[model samples]
Target: MDKTPLTDPALAQLFTQARTYNSWSDRPVDDATVRQLYALVSAGPTTANSHPGRFVFIRSAAARARLRPHLSAGNVEKTMAAPCCVIVAYDTRFHEFMPQLFPSRDFSATFAGKDAVIADTAMRSSTLAGAYLILAARALGLDAGPMSGFDKDTLEAEFFPDGRWKANFLCNIGYGTDDQLFPRNPRLAFEQACLDL
Candidate 1:
């Protein structure tokens, strides 16, 4: 298998040049693209293949209106204006799927009666899946604005009525413009962020 590196342009498009957008154009993100994004992102690996992540794409004015009251004041306009806003959540009963995801053995027993273990995997693995979604969206020529400025409890009550799933974070997706971007923030060097140990 070839281990060829990505081209500079591709790297820039997905990482170096990617920005958390606050403003988007009038063009909308079609449903087909959203489904394609999910298919591409679902291939990403997760702990125990828990695959707890679930998403609610708020593309309609009525749904966005329902989501508005849960958001922080600062996040209101940006979220409502984006072509699509996603409610990234996790399933508390994720272990139920373990027999299918990790079918080599019966792993569901590991979390059968453990609520804490279930919660931990739900949050951690869902977050990883959310990251995969963001990257997949970028690769498909879209921008993602991942944020956490919302009331999780309120969102869950509004979106997840059965209490089966819980909100982790919110992300607005679209083709962004430089108009709302603040200056690029500084990043830590590898020496500052990592340790050999």
Candidate 2:
């Protein structure tokens, strides 16, 4: 841990005070802000810095309309109403960058031929990168609502026509409305969720 931890107010803003919002205010999130958010997120650690995560920021009405048909009934209205929804995805060919990003060992060729390893690495690293984006958003004074309640195949077909990128999840971004938040749910106790082996 750092000699001095983050201030309590900052901690609360990013963690305790944060809620997975189902309603958004009319305030818009600009392209610059989202770009800054990505820069922050990309700096987080990843396996071999594979940096597989990719994002599609759905801002236009047409894009949102296209996404709606893929979302579950419970997610459509809220997702569509948000200012933007980020499609967090992974590139199947992420290993192609290993030579550039991890030149010390330069294992790109080895990774390129291993389909199972590629799939596992892409899924795990991309999911972690998505989580980083959520934290980065809160750190930048924006709220995030991450969801996995969409038809992945439909989203990929509609958005990633080349078939190289695949959707991992979706996260809506914007200012939030308090009335839409449900009562807080309790989290597991430390002993129940952690093991100190």
Please name the candidate that would achieve the greatest TM-score relative to the true structure: 1
Error (Å) of candidate 1 at residue 26 is: 1.2
User: Tens digit of lDDT per residue, candidate 2, span 67-123?
Assistant: 999999999889988999999999999998887888889686678689999999999
Clashing pairs in 2: none
- Tell me the alpha-carbon RMSD of every candidate: 1.1, 1.5
- Model 1 ranges with Cα > 4 A deviation: none
lDDT of each: 0.92, 0.92
Error of 2 at 21 (Å): 0.5
Per-model clash counts, in order, read: 0, 0
Q: In lDDT terms, how accurate is model 2? A: 0.92
Tell me each candidate's TM-score: 0.97, 0.96
The sequence of per-residue lDDT tens digits that candidate 1 reaches over residues 1-197 is: 98999999999989998889999987899989999989987899988788999999999999999999999999999999998999999999988888888889898678989999889989999999899989999999999999999998888999999999999999999989888998889999999999998
Off by over 4 Å in 2: 1-3
Evaluate candidate 2 by giving its C-alpha RMSD to the native, one decimal: 1.5
